[model samples]
Target: MESKIILITGATNGIGKAAAKELAKQGHTVIVHGRNKDKTLRVLEEIKAETGNANIDILLGDLFLLSDVKKMADDVKKKYQKLDVLINNAGGTMGKVREATDEGFEKTIVLNLLSPFLLTQSLLPLLSNAPSARIINVSSEMHKFGGKPFFHDFQLEKNYDSVRAYGLSKLYLIWISRHLSAELKPKNITVNTVHPGVSNTNFGLDADRGFFTNLVGKLLMRFSLTAEQGAASLIYLASSDDVEHVTGLYYGPKKKPAEPSDRYYSIENENRVWGYCSQIVAPYMDT
Candidate 1:
């Protein structure tokens, strides 16, 4: 495989981390991103040691903040003139109750939806500079659960459930992927979303949840995929020539096109969500 520049967010854990290791092993210039500096560096070194590939690099930022997203983009642009692929793999579910970020958006929505929107928009210049670039978004099948957004209260302001909030965030991301695929098709940049399939990782454990919810989450683990198995689809999208031209589609572990939700395929809903997110991140779209 030819070497390419690849950036993966939330690479310090789970599927993102597994993908980063696989990419690095393939001799690509892998940039691993994480929230903490120490852990980020540790993961970088660990990947280097495990893969025996010294080309791995690190970028640190809190994806929940638009300002931090812009800062991370600026750093990437300063260092590299071209980015062959961008894996928007950094996202997670919030606790039982909804919490707002400093920016006023719900924490779940900000981390999963707005962060990727701003980061991708800001990095478009670099992504466009490459001969052919791909944007792989890590989304979930649960998107169908909350595909119908409460337009009147887009942020789940009135009523908040952690699972639904998570589904809503992933749904928005899949829509953004579809919208961007169309926008960037002329530029030779393919954008796609993948459902990593319930992986056995430290996902819901970090949240402050009730005993019952936690117990259910743990029980579900028995049917979950290992982190490495979960990352197969992501690795395929990022490195497979078979999917090089594939864009604006949802993929499952089978490496085939999968349906997101009947609601998400609606043109009206796509535009509505795009317009809403664009307006919210207007100030950060200067790039």
Candidate 2:
């Protein structure tokens, strides 16, 4: 494989970190994102030492804030002339109650959806500079469990549940992937989403949880896939030749094209959600 400039969001831990190591091992320039300056640097150095690839770099941002996402994008644009691939992998679940970021957007929606939307839109020019660019979104199979999004209330303001919020966010991400795939077709940019399976990573441990819930989550982590294993599908979608031309699709276990829930297939919902996201991120995105 040829060396490429790849940026992965939320790469300080779990599947994102694992994917960064694997890609760097392949001799690609891997730019990883983390929320903390120190942790990001540590992960960056670790990947470099492990892969013997000094090209590894880091970017820090709190995905929940659109401003941070834009700043990160601007930094990338100024530093890299071309971005061969972008992996929107930074996301997590919130607690039982609703939590809003300082920006007023729900934490789950902003981190899992809006951040990627704004980042990708802002960096389209850099992606377009490459011969063929790929956008791999990290979604979840659990999306089916999180009932369809309340299109009217996209924020879950009326009734909020942790599982529901997480599922809706993932589902909406897949929908956005499909919608954007069409939008970028003329540019030869492939956009696809993947389910990393259930990984035994510190995924939701950071969220506030009750004693029982926390215990259950810890015990359940033992039975899931290792972080490296969970990143397999992500690696496939990000660099595989078989999927070079494939877009607007979801890949799950076995790295096969899987169908999302029926709710994600609704054209009406897709258009509405796409327009809504565009409007929300317009101020942060370039004209």
Candidate 3:
């Protein structure tokens, strides 16, 4: 419960917001992140007021934009010499259609997988400076197994489904995280992924399909999990002293190890994914 610096994304609401509040309550210098400036400020204020911990700061940006990601992480680096924890929790289904991001890539995969990989790489200096640090990525059990990301037509130009795209993004995240855990082993920076049980929160609702998702689907998702229930695995990985040295593993609620679906555990398959992502993000990887 030391006053360590921890930066978390998607903190305006839902699981990410819950994590910011819990970490602040525990006395960490929580840096809350969200794209909406007003909502981000509100969340920070609530956390500070509830925890009486004004050490919280806010960093705002769209996770899909690499420039925005760099800017946010760089801004944090300028202010803090050490980053005790990083929760890569910003994510969602980027709609059913395959929309290209500003960076000219599939939106869902880029936001959920590529953005975290890039952001974490960019923040390594700060993370490594801390005596002990952890990177807890919000991965999902859905990553257990699937066909390799279409290496040639990677963004599914042929056929695109929102649910499947989101799941594929999470699957890539686990592989990236597992690879990073190994790469950072010498540096004592534990890299782990968490399956924050499907807690009800706003993820899929948007303009294209607002009425159906917001009125019906969102209620069901919310019913699945109170934010507190969803944030459990994240909190465990972020704050627990028991799993301090645990790395390259998947965690579920109650701090239990998650048995990935049969398809996801293939080291060979994961390695294939690691190579692909690393190549794509190589230009941004300085360290």
lDDT of each: 0.89, 0.90, 0.82
Best of the candidates, TM-score: 1
Instruction: Tell me, by lDDT, which candidate is best.
Output: 2
In model 3, state the lDDT of residue 18: 90
Question: What range of 10 consecutive residues in model 1 has the weakest lDDT sum?
Answer: 145-154
TM-score winner between candidates 1 and 3: 1
Candidate 1 versus the native: TM-score?
0.97
Of models 1 and 3, which has the larger lDDT? 1
Residue lDDT tens for model 3, 72-154: 87788888888989999999776655788768778888889888988898899999999989999998766653354565555
lDDT of 2 by residue, 1-287 (tens): 87889999999999999999999998989999999999999999899889999998888899989999999999999899999999999999888779998889999989998999999999999999999999999999878978857888888888688888888889889988999999999999999999988899989898876677677878878888999998998888887788888999998856887888875568888888899899999999876
For candidate 2, report its TM-score: 0.96
lDDT of 1 by residue, 1-287 (tens): 88999999999999999999999999999999999999999999999999999999999899888888988998998999999999999998888888998888898888999999988988999998988999999999888886457777778999788888888889889988999999999999999999988889888888976789789888887799999988998899999888888889999876777887866468888898899989888887763
Count backbone clashes in candidate 2.
0
- Regions more than 4 Å wrong, model 1: none
